[model samples]
Target: MLDVLSEGFKEAKLKLKGKAVLNESNVKEAIDAIRKSLLEADVEYSVTKNFLQRVQEKALGQEVALRAGKGDSRVAVSPADHFVMICKEELEQLMGPVNAELNMAVNRPTTIMMVGLQGSGKTTSTGKLAKYLVNKDKKKPLLVAADIYRPAAVQQLKVLGERIGVPVFHKEGADPVTICKEALQKAFDLGCDVVLFDTAGRLTIDSALMQELADIQSATKPDNVLLVCDAMMGQDAVTTAKSFDERLSLSGVIMTKLDGDARGGAALSIKEVTGKPIKFLGMGEDLDRLEEFRPEGLASRILGLGDIVGLMQDFQKVAEEDQEAQALKLLQGQFSYIDFYKQIEMIQKMGSLKDLIAKMPMQDMIPKGANIDDRELTKVKAMIDSMTKRERIGQDNLDRPRMARIARGSGRPVKEVEELHKRFTAMRKMMGMLGKNMGGLLGKIPGMGTLGQMNNMRKAASQMGQMPGGLGGMGDMGSMFGDSASKPKPAFDREKQKKMRKAAKDARKRNRK
Candidate 1:
């Protein structure tokens, strides 16, 4: 997501590579690239300056040189890698430690007060947090619609409550403070362990708005006061966090719209500038897309190292609770179109493919021009729906005629249907290979890498066409995603291809003439 920020660190790594050791001149050259990137990303100047200083200080320190060519992990660390390690450690330090999760109370009915500027996604984040509590934390949560100032804010919260199966507490013609106080009683009646107050936001922070929030906070005495800042707000998000922290003494921050925020200055800046932990990151508009903020994973992603742990967590969220048994069954070779359909659903629920790929170290293994389309799942589903019951259950494997029928029924090309079937066949074999080793992988997510499962994945990927960096190239990802990367392509002879195409076009023109 932070492409610009990543490019900076990548450039710095290139600058330091093949060097005997870190030196002030080379380090400064690398830092200059990083400095330009940070400023371009809209990071706060002070935070950027301080972060670079910490990174540079450690990079040139004696420990880095001593540890050069050695690593705590299995792999050896080169000078360039050691330098990047310094940068990564410093970046993680700057972002602060992981919040673990929302700070809940020992007693029942933990109150979480959500505050932010208007249009900052306070209400949506409240619903997402409630969904997180329900799905991940397995606790009863009540959504409090205390944003009475904005028109339809209560109704909006009600819709979200219905969507997430959480109860909404709102009073007609009641003030925000009163609504919050009464919502506590409702939570008590409902036996909800968590109560989230989606407090009213303002176009701009003002005395009257802050006073209203202060009144609610004073009355309810929330256990957590989270300020939801829009990531796209950049430095202004930092400013908003500052203002809110000063007024309400915020417990933590929730950064929203990170999926759309390419620069990611706010996410990197808010924690350092405001001295608050980023508890969760709001990735997309989906209620289930709120991710717990892990500084280590984020720092890795920002430096283009990829966050395998985070990627596993995303997979765990989608598959652990509802689809664990199903996923395991499919992995055990009982897979069919019915199960493949569910796989597509799980992938869709896991959010965007591009974002998922961004969290993988093998992201570059994808073909350079490959386009990972989320809508491809819908198309695959359409094709599956066109098949008969026997075909779906894998009792009657599809022949060419059957595939043609499905293509016509689904309004797709026959080649696409054929490709789907081929990819599905390949995946069925791969899953059969992985069935034994990956039995409990879904349940052990976020730590699956440490559980000796990455090797299992590599083995599974090898059962199909192996890619350079593992994960079975685009063929396996193609099997999962049904994207253009379903087949690995040879590196092109660009000039040869260009000349051939030009000659063909000229011959066609001559024939026409």
Candidate 2:
């Protein structure tokens, strides 16, 4: 979502490379790049200017000893890395301290009044918030359809509530405030502790809308008033948020359509502008696609460092008890076709593969034009489904005749099945090698010899099934970042580079033939 900002930071980092320190000249250039990127992303002019000024002051004020190749070289942080880290820290500070919790009343049902302009996804966000509260917080939420002016707004809320298994309270021809007041009573009667008011929205803010919302607020005495903003609206979203907060005293914001081509300026600007935290990000249209906003995670993603914590959170959400065992087995090269199919299912549950990949660190390593086709996983699943249990578990049992039968059953070519088998075999071999060689690779690092031995012991225990499930014995991932910081960059190997180029040329020639 912050693709433009990410690219800009990457460019700025490159510009700082080989430079000694963050002096006025170099700092100006880097900040200019950032300024252009933010402006292009539709950030508010004042916010962008203030942010850049702070970044510049911080960068220029840092000790010269902190520069790359200065001070104690062993522990010296590179200027480029230092500058990027400053930017990352500033970005996080600008966005938030990670406050997404909804405020619930102690004695009564927590009335969460959802307010926004038309087409801002207020109704959909209401359903998503309900589902989140139900599944994550174990709250029984009653959805209120208070947007009586908009055609089918009530029906839409009902459909969303039905899909999410939340009860919808709507009374036709009722005033918005009256509907919300009645909805609160219904929540009390139905044992729903959370009441989500899906209030009406207009194409633009007006006195009539504001007065109606104010009336509803006065009657309901909501615990939390959240504005559902469209991230695509950019600066306008921030303006709308400020307007709403001024009137309704919004508790927080939910940014919808963040998965679209949003420049992400609103997400970065709204909290700073309105003095409200972003509670959730509406990543997609699905009722289950809402994500609690994590400022550190977003800042990491914006800096192209990826969000490992968010990725793990996503994994934890969909991971089954046996899935961890399966992952361990796959790492040990003992996984079968059945395990492969199950892994695919787990990934599908986690959401889009592209989105998942985007959360990986150093994602720029992926080929620029290459795309991950989710359909490919479905195709693989279809082929696996066509296979007998024996054939799935024992590849050696699948001779040409068996492969042909499976291909016919799967409605795919026999060659495609063969190719899949070949790739699977290669993957198993590579994973096996990686598992065995990981300790050695770690030991080769400057100060990780003890860690390498520990890793080996953990690996041994994992192989014997003595370790706990879900990477329990994999040790702390935080250590990896520490190791990376202390480790020396690898020297380029000319021979290896030449061989890679030659191999690529050969592959292209073979394809043409």
Using Cα atoms with residue i matched to residue i, what is each candidate's TM-score against the true structure?
0.81, 0.81
TM-score of candidate 2 to 2 decimals = 0.81
Q: Quickly count the clashes in candidate 2.
A: 0
Candidate 1, which segments miss by more than 4 Å at Cα?
63-74, 101-103, 106-108, 320-334, 366-370, 429-513
CA lDDT of each prediction against the hidden true structure: 0.83, 0.81
Q: lDDT per residue, candidate 1, 357-395, as tens digits?
A: 889886434544456666767888899999999999888
User: Per-residue alpha-carbon lDDT of model 2 for 151-173, expressed as tens digits?
Assistant: 88889988998898889998877
Looking at candidate 2, what is the lDDT of residue 98?
83
**How does model 1 fare in lDDT?**
0.83
- Candidate 2 off by > 4 Å: 64-76, 399-415, 432-513
What is the alpha-carbon lDDT for the whole of candidate 2? 0.81
**Cα error, candidate 1, residue 460 (Å):** 13
